[model samples]
Each structure stands twice: as structure tokens, then as C-alpha cells.
Target: ACLSRLELSALKFISGLNSGLISGLNLGEEKIMSEKIRFSVVCVCLILSFAVMPSGAAYAKRELRGKIYMVGEKDEDIPSKNTTIRIEESDDSDVSTDTAAFRLFIKDHYKTDETVTLKVEKPGYQIWQPVAGKVRIPANLENYHEKVRLDKLGSHRFMSNQAFAMLIENAARESTKTVSKSDEKPDLSRYLKEWAVKYGFGIDDVKTEMDKWAADIEKRQDNLYELGLAAFYRKNFKEADEKFIDMANLPVDWAQTQYNLADTYFAMEDWAKAAECYKNVLKVYPNYKKAIERLKLIREKR
Candidate 1:
């Protein structure tokens, strides 16, 4: 019969203790004191062996092993190391990974449709979740694999509350610059688009807030150009056309608005109007490469 390392160590320590006790019975105070120290050492060794055995047994019984990877923008996958994995409702069952893999052990097998919430955490990345930083795991599963894509801190998109708040702050800064009398006007259209992409402005609640922001910004006459571009992005062509036309009528340089109006007409398939707008853009901003290319395409089409 084969014995485990713990059992073998326990047996050896017990044998030594028995021999030492027997020898100390006939020995003086010095030998007795030595025996007492040996016995204490053996007791500590035995206790540690027993304590470690159960944890080893529990590790052996782990039925689920998971592999995790971080997905990159180019669809490359890299191991996600140093991440904390936690199972909700399991006492002391959380583990942090030094590598990209983690193992999970349960006291009992799970029932059908049983689910547990899993939380992942890392320093510079967003917490993995369906909405934010939590995910649902089926308890009855085994040998699971997860692909985690965590947005970095201060990135265009962030899932954590702290990161999202940072994104909002950055957006607000850009917003302030839009109405400021700086030598260079900040591109409000691009700023709002980036915010929408990050915060999912397609959702109704997000759209509501974004619309309110747009309304506030539209109060400034200088912001009309960006409002028109934002409307163009939203596919509100009527509003975009109105805003662009309003910008074009303004006394300021209207070359950019003319170009945008041409693009909008092209989207609407009004080739004649588009051609006219392109001509106006070229008249004002000669050597505009895009307008030159578009005119060539329109001539070929005609």
C-alpha cells in the first residue's frame, strides 16, 4: 500500500516520539528536557501535516478549471494574469491568479440552471461584467473558458464607475473648450461622437442625456457646425441639412460647412445638389483634396 507524504511524515514523527519517550523514562533531567522538546516538535509537525492534507484533498476535488484571455483590438488573444476571480455566495472561495488559469472547487455538485455571480478585478483594466464588473456563471458547468476584454483606464470606453467618471470629466473638458474663445475651435462633433461611442448613446437613457447636452450646446451660435455634424452622424438628415444651411449662411468662413453639406447631399443621393455644394467648397477652399476627388467622381458619373 502506498502512503501520502503527509501520512508518511506523521508516521515517522510518531515513531520518533515513541522512541524518545521510552528513552527519557530511564534518563536524567537533561535527557527528559531534550525528549520534551522533541515531543513538542513532533506534535507541531503532525498538526501541520494533518492541516495541510485536507487542503490538498480539496484542491484535488476541484472539478472546474478555467482559462482566461484578454482580447485585443486586432482580435489577438493574450493571457490575462494577476486577476482576481470570485464566486458569489461561496465563503473564502475567492482566488487570485498569478497566471491566466484558475481552478474552482465546490463542496457539492450544482443543480441544473444553478448560477453564480463571478467578479474579476485588476489594477488598470475595467472589471469584467455583462453591464459593468460582474458576470453570471452556470454552476453546473465544468472546464469553462472565458475571453475577457477590459477597457483600460481613461480609455474611450470604460466599464467601471471610476473609469466612466473619468471619461465624463474628459468629455466635460472638451465641452468647455467647444464654447471657449480659443484661437482654435475644438471639434464638438468628434467630441460628442467619442462620448456616445463610449457611453452607448444608442440606449434610450443615454440618448436622452445626450440630446439634452446637445440642446444646451446648440444655444451657442458657434456650435451650430458641430450640432449639424452630430445630427448627420445620428442619421437625422433633415436637422443636419438645416444646421449646415444655417452655418453656411453665417458671415464666418463656410468652406467646412459647404463640404459637409455636399457629403450630406451625397448620402441623400442628390447628386446635383451635392455637385453644387462641392463646387461651392472648391470655390472657397481651393486645393481641397476630397472636394477635388468628389468632383472627378461626379463628372464620371454624369
Candidate 2:
């Protein structure tokens, strides 16, 4: 009997035996040859499977990159001069205890042990750098808006604060000088009174200096409030109050200035003025929480 299995290769072998004569081939020999052919086919299939197996390179992760900025500020990628911002991962489920190093990771293909140096510049500001030779980004760097504060060097480099301070001081000084040179002395008593009341400057102290030259009452008010706001942000509440109160009569920036004035009143425990300021705040921002609460408390006490 002929081999039951379809051994096409074995049949080729038999046919290549000088002539196409399968009839004379022994059934036992044909069956053995067919088995070898089937085994060879299985081997070929296995080889193909191994050749196309998936690789680890297909699933590798890529690096990330982006610029960092301070809260409520903008700067270009060319290092912000006065800023030292750090990038950090958004997920804080895992924490670390590295105080000296910042936990910001900027994925610019920064390999471990790689040293990178770049300058951070800001307009009218100075550049700053990471403490060590390298900027170490925390492993978990996929999340969160990290805070970057001004270092000592950063402050010295970015002279915005100093510049602003000098501007105010100069204006005060120059106004006095101009008054001395002017043909007519300006009535600076109002300006001095407002400055004292707004910035908590004992009006009596500056009264003589202010009276020395007729001051530009309105211009002086602006300068005082601007300085006072800067001082307020710096936590000098006494100075802030003086500035806000002196410019109270000016029509511009009334709402915010009044609101800030109210805050100072609340801080000083002048409840009556505080209540009045709160009322004014409501007229501007009806839903201001602090003002609303303070106003309500003032009414309750009455």
C-alpha cells in the first residue's frame, strides 16, 4: 500500500529516481520518507515563529522637556536671570528626604551622571544656577507646578526689586530737590499728611521736609502708594497703610486700594474704619470673603 500521508517532498524524491514510477516504490520506504518530510515542515514553522518574536526595544520610554516659570510670571527658555525654578513630578505618593537637591526633572534625554550647564536669564534680572555641578531632577518628574524662589545670588542679579526701591527713593528725593529749585513753593502739607496717614509715617516727622518744597501732591501720592504696596508685599503693613490712606482721594485704583486699606484697618483693629472699608470692598467685589465676613462681624458688634 502507498503511504497514507501526503509527503510531497518524498514523492519528489521517488519521482527523481530516474523516472516517475511511484507504483514500484515500496510502501514501507514511502511511509518512512513521508515522516521525515512532515518533521522538516514542523521545524521550518518553529524557526519562523522565533524569528518574528517581539523585542524589549519596542516598549522603551522616551524623555520629556519644557521650560519652568515662577507663579504669575513669564520668561523665555534662555534661563530666567533672577529665577531658580525647579521642575518636579506631579505625583507625590512617594516622597524623598533630599534637602540639598531639588526634585525637578526635565526630560531632555538627560542621562544619569551627565553634567549639563545652562544659563537662566530674565529681562532686567540676573542668572542663577543649581547648587552642585549638575541639576538633579527627581525620578518622579511627571507632575506638579514647582516653586522657584530667588536665591541670594538671584536677588543680586535680578535688580527689579532694588531698581523699584531706588526709583521710589529717587522720586522722593528729586521731588524735594525740584521744590527747592522752583520759583513757587508747592503746598506739600496735604501730601505729607496723606503719606503719614497711609504709610504710618508720623506726619509730624516728615512735616518739615515736606513743607520745605511745595510737593506735587498727586504725583507724590502715587509714588507713596506704589512704595507702600511694595512694602506691603514685603510684609510692612504699617508702611502699606500709610500709602493707601494718603492716595485715598485720588479717583484711580479706588476699589483695590480701598480694599487693601480695609485689610489694614482690620489688621489694626480699627473696627469702624474696617467696617467702612469692607462696605467699600463689597461695592467693588460683592463676594469678597474677608470683606464680607469682617463687615458682618462689625455689624453684629454694633
Candidate 3:
């Protein structure tokens, strides 16, 4: 069976956990991780326990020690091994080229939500990711592991998340058919050609404009929510408020977004605005425990 991107990533996640590459929390195991890496994981876990995840509820941060891979038509063989990855603004390629894995000063980046700019530059290839989220340094072990998806240079957009989903759905619906060796091969070019007729340019063009897919403010609901969450985890509470408030005013019934805005406000100790937002969350989800508890705490403060 040909797995889709999500399925492939899930397999990688499980593999990482088994191999001790899942760098989420470090119980100070010296044999498993370096001292700096251990501290970084501890910081991330502490933040999760106090602020975001609340017993690892949702948000998480982890280091990036994975390979750079190609977003080719083939789902099974994704990694573009030996393709050198250089961190942004650096002039040198990594000395180790076998794994296509670049080293980062991960101890610093993993503990905070700082944006790390990256690009994939092989002489004849480029990046094409449409539904790609911004990757913070170090893959999020709690969430799906991220692959630095690179692809061959083309006017045609290869393996867009849209077309990938279509391919996966089509494969599933045809699963009962007689098996053939020829059917096992992935044909990514067909989807690329199809989407090229519709969207004009590849998702990010050649510059690796990281927010190319996210620049459209009219389709801003999910973007703003993620931005708020990122800022909140970074402890940039003021910036988090700005993003969350913008998200809250949008025409959507997102109780969690309202609850997040309330959480941000309470973090700032703005009791009135926090109370107002918690009430907004209750209007949508009346029995949400976190919101209910926060509102009561605010009332007690008053």
C-alpha cells in the first residue's frame, strides 16, 4: 500500500521514538542526549506544564535533528540523501552530506519559538510546499515530525498538499483492485501538471519565501490562531494578544480561539478583558473547564 505524507510522517515519528531521536523531554540521561540538549528539552517541558500544554495538552517544542527530504511524487522514498542543507544566512554547506541533515545550535532554538529561516538549494532543484506550516527549529515531538520538503525545480508545482490529498483519496478508493507492480510507482508529475494549469506559479517560487502560502490576509483565520499560539509559547504575551484579538474578531465560531485569547489576557493579568473573553468562550462552549476555572479566578481577583 502506498502511504500518503501524513502516514509516512507518522511512521517516522514512531521510528524516532524507538531510536531515541524523539527529543521532547530529557530526564538528564547523559548517554541519550548532550547536556545542552537535555536542558533545552527540560525548558520546553516546563513551559508546556505551566503555560501551553497543561499536562501536555496540545502545544509542544522539540529540536530538529532530522534529514532534509525531497517532496517527490514517490511517497515511500522521500529523503533526498546527500543533498546538503545550510542554515539561512550561512555561506557553508554542512560537512556531513550523507544524511542531508544539517546541524543547528539547537539548545537555544528548541527552548523558544524563534523563527529559523532555512532554504534547500540543489543546483537543479527547488522547494514546493503549499500546505506547509512554518517549521520552528527542532521538530515538534508531541506533534507530527516535520520533514524539510524539497523538490526538483519546475514551473510545475510538484506534490502540493492539495494534490497529495487527492492522490491519497484516489489510492484508498481503488485499494480493492488487483495488485500490479506498475501500480506501486508514484506518478507526481501528473498532479503537478494538473495544478500548474490552475495556480500559475509554484507555491513559494524560488526564494523560499516562508510565508508565501500564509500571506493572504482574507483567508486569515487559521493563520492568526497559529501565530497567536506561537507567540504565546515564546512568552511574547503582548504579541500573542495582538494575533488572538485579530483572530477573535473574525466571523467564526472558534471557542478555542476565544479561550486562547482569554488565556493570553489572563497571563497578562488583564482581568477585565480576560473575563470578557472567557465569557465569550462560555457562550460557545458553556462547560469548558479551563475557561470556567479562569473566570472564577478572575472573579476572585476582583
User: Which numbered prediction scores highest in lDDT against the true structure?
Assistant: 1
Per residue, candidate 2 scores C-alpha lDDT tens digits across 1-302 of 33323444444554464243334669887776666655765565555555555665554342223333322234333222323433233221112122312333344556643434323333432222222112334354444223333222323232232223323334444444656654544343454455344323465644443332213323444345454535443445567567657656555478788888988987888889888777665444433445766886878876
| TM-score of structure candidate 3 | 0.32
Q: Score each candidate by Cα lDDT.
A: 0.57, 0.45, 0.51
Off by over 4 Å in 3: 1-63, 89-96, 107-111, 129-134, 138-146, 155-302
Please give the lDDT score at residue 241 for candidate 2: 66
TM-score of each: 0.30, 0.20, 0.32
Alpha carbon lDDT at 10, candidate 3:
52
How close is each model in CA RMSD to the real structure?
Answer: 21.9, 22.6, 26.1
Could you give candidate 1's per-residue lDDT for residues 35-115 as a string of tens digits? 666677667666876676656545565344565556467756567776776665574244537567766554465543344
Report the CA-based lDDT of candidate 1 relative to the real structure: 0.57
Who wins the TM-score comparison? Answer: 3
TM-score of 2: 0.20
Better-scoring candidate (TM-score), 2 or 3: 3
